[model samples]
Target: MTILCVRFQLPSAHETAFPELLGLLEEFTPVVEALPPDGALADLRGAERYFGRGAVELASVIRVRALALHGVDCVIGAGPGPMLARVAQRAARPGVTCAVSAGEARDFLAGKPVAALPGVGAATARTLCEYGLDTLGRVAAAPLSTLQRLVGAKAGRELHEKANGVDRGRVVPNAVSRSLAAERRFPRDELDPVRHRRALLSAGEELGARLRAVEKVCRTLTLTVRYADRSSTTRGRTLGEPTAHSADLTRTAYSLYEALGLQRARVRAIALRAEGLGPADRASHQLTFDPADEKARRIEEVADRARAKFGPRAVMPGGLAA
Candidate 1:
């Protein structure tokens, strides 16, 4: 086992501490991919040799260090590759690390449900189960041609390869993203969709203003909703165009919230992160013939100027008004 997939037991109140946990992992290995809101995947091939320890041993130290330094405890899974590591993680609990050695890779993957494989969505799992290929063992035994016929040529080939416990995936090193974040916490658990939208609107406006002030444009928006039970759901969307526009940010935030289909959710807080930042001047604005859109942009420019000259509170979207 060379890779480690770690899931941190981070509560919503401590959400901002995720980066520090990622940094701790980086001390062990450079190839740490942040699976945000609370987890990461770290490739530890070099670390094993350097630390004179196995992946599982290193995991114990990591767990202790995380708890000691950050007060964060994590469950870990170690395997030959990212896929196996992720599977091992599901079987692992806090204070323990599940390690899948190379010799047991095939047997370990064999009895798993098709849905256990990464990237195999519910629809794909249903389709595979319908064909009596309900488990990875069956999928591994199936002919490549048959799997291809059932799914697509490329997807079927991948499925067959992964079912046999081959590690085609590698851990990508995490790079720090230049991003802006804003969060709004409700006084109590909120279930109303209108209030949820209001929180999104508030966060978007803050992010957009910060980006514009810094002369940056962001190509992606991430939304994180913290629930009353301390769990959170995170979703990210690539924008149609890079933008520092408040309206565009708010609109995208609204769409992401709608896609969650959690109109009656007991939400505690909403946070928005604008990422993939770059020079605003290099970004192109989508031109539209609609006069309403044109008017909105013109008004937005004026509003930006007003906020700059006066204060952020000088202007606000009607929905965000107190």
Candidate 2:
């Protein structure tokens, strides 16, 4: 099975607009591993034969399509597995796709820095370097017992496994992020408490809308408030019932925000996260007598329909684009 890891190299001009580019990638393969707002890893194992092209040829086609459709360049690494694919992509500069045959993964990784090995963070690298393990080849050749003594049993075993290019990590299918998040920063910090509340509400609304669209329900809400001094506090609430209802999400988010007590504070941004997602169809919504709840959901359905037809911004809740 061949996996292709494509790193979409977003230019400075479109840095924050990478999700738009990911939408383009989704056209090629539904098994896209979103690296979120930047790059993606695609399992193109079965696609090659279906497309009647070799992996290299398909990579070229993808590069051409990305350039033409999104006006973006990418570095694609093609290999028989995820680790090799990721390493191959790292070897390619922007606008190129490099394919490594399965047989060459070891040679390709051998002379690279130990730091190039995944999971070898700075502290580990420093420790390894002190022991003359500057390169992957050296690490691979080292006594596993010695490495354990240096970096502990677990880290050492993992390092020995990866340095020898023995990664067995599967390309996970149906992997969804544990949390759904929406965040917005003001062009300038604001001191109004009402505006901050509005920002939290809007973020909540966005999160809820996304959950509904994706057919998921979340069991908890977390709100993060960022202040002018760049410090922030996060508060969370467990929902009484799992829901994708915008009003419920908004109320929870607002309560979490208010709990931070940012009166007369310089607020820079607000972030809301919905956590512990499950299938929306499986979730049970508690009955409520509040007429306002029904009204808000009715309005949300209309907004969703409008956005589906006209575009995402056509019916955004207040404070999102502010």
Candidate 3:
């Protein structure tokens, strides 16, 4: 069975729009798996016969539809299985689709950094590099027992399988959950509250756009702050009403951050999650006669259109221009 893994380079505004993207993928195949934030995996075993197109051609079709319909470009990688497909997708160029033949899976994985393998993080890569097992070829060539001794029994065996392109996992079709999240990690520890609020605004904008894209409304917002010491704190607040409005999300995010009273805290990263999501059609908005509220909503709609036609940067919150 062939599987295609697609990764999207979502602009900050569309970071949480994975659900909308998944809906697009479902048009091509029923067996679509959502990769939250910005990606998905589709099983194309029988889709070839159904669509009368090869894997590569079908991938192009998906890319075209996504761009034409939602102004999102996708990179796709096709292979016999999920691991190979994900690896190929990572190697793909922007706005392009690539495929890996079954015979070439090992050759494709060979010579790549060990970090390219799934689940091998920075610390693991350092450990492997110290032992001269820094490449997939080296890992694949190593004895399983030796790898077990180096890493551990379970991780070592899994690494060996992945290094040799031996993944047996299948793409299971499932709906993305009701919540969406976005996070930003600072280049260094950030102590300034201005930078913190800026990050929160960015995340809020992203979550709002995503919720709107998917036609959902969130009734609550959660803010998580990761400190330089690796500890983290999370706070959540219930909104007055469910909303997909960026302004509402931004207000709630700022309030949550302020509640933390993070004076002088060196924050490493900040994340915002929108929860209690439901269809936007089901949400009820209070009647507002205020001209400012109406004006802001109108401007937001125009900005959304501008972003869809041009790119996410076509319109950004003024405060986040820096």
Candidate 2's residue-wise lDDT over 1-322, tens digit each? 3677788878788876566555444333435577765667776643443343566777787788778867878888888777778788888876666777766767778899988876678999999999899998898899999999999999899888877777676565332445667777888998987778787777777677667665678899988888899998888999999998888898888777777766688889988878777778998877687798778778988987766556556776656666
Rank the candidate models, highest TM-score first.
Answer: 1, 3, 2
Q: Which prediction has the highest lDDT against the true structure?
A: 1
Total clashing residue pairs per candidate? 0, 0, 0
Ranking by lDDT: 1, 3, 2
**In model 2, what lDDT does residue 175 have?**
29
Candidate 1 lDDT for residue 273? 84
> Which wins on TM-score, candidate 2 or candidate 3?
3
lDDT of 3 by residue, 189-246 (tens): 9999999999999988877766665566888899999999999999999999999899
- How does each model score on TM-score? 0.55, 0.52, 0.53
Error of 2 at 4 (Å): 1.6
RMSD of each: 16.2, 13.2, 16.3
Candidate 1 lDDT tens digits, 96-185: 899998778889999999999998999999999999999999999999999999899999999999999887899876636456577899
Measured on C-alpha atoms, candidate 3 has an lDDT of 0.82
Candidate 1 ranges with C-alpha deviation above 4 Å: 177-322
Model 1, residue 55: distance off in Å is: 0.8
**Pairs in steric clash, model 1:** none
Give the Cα lDDT of each candidate: 0.85, 0.75, 0.82
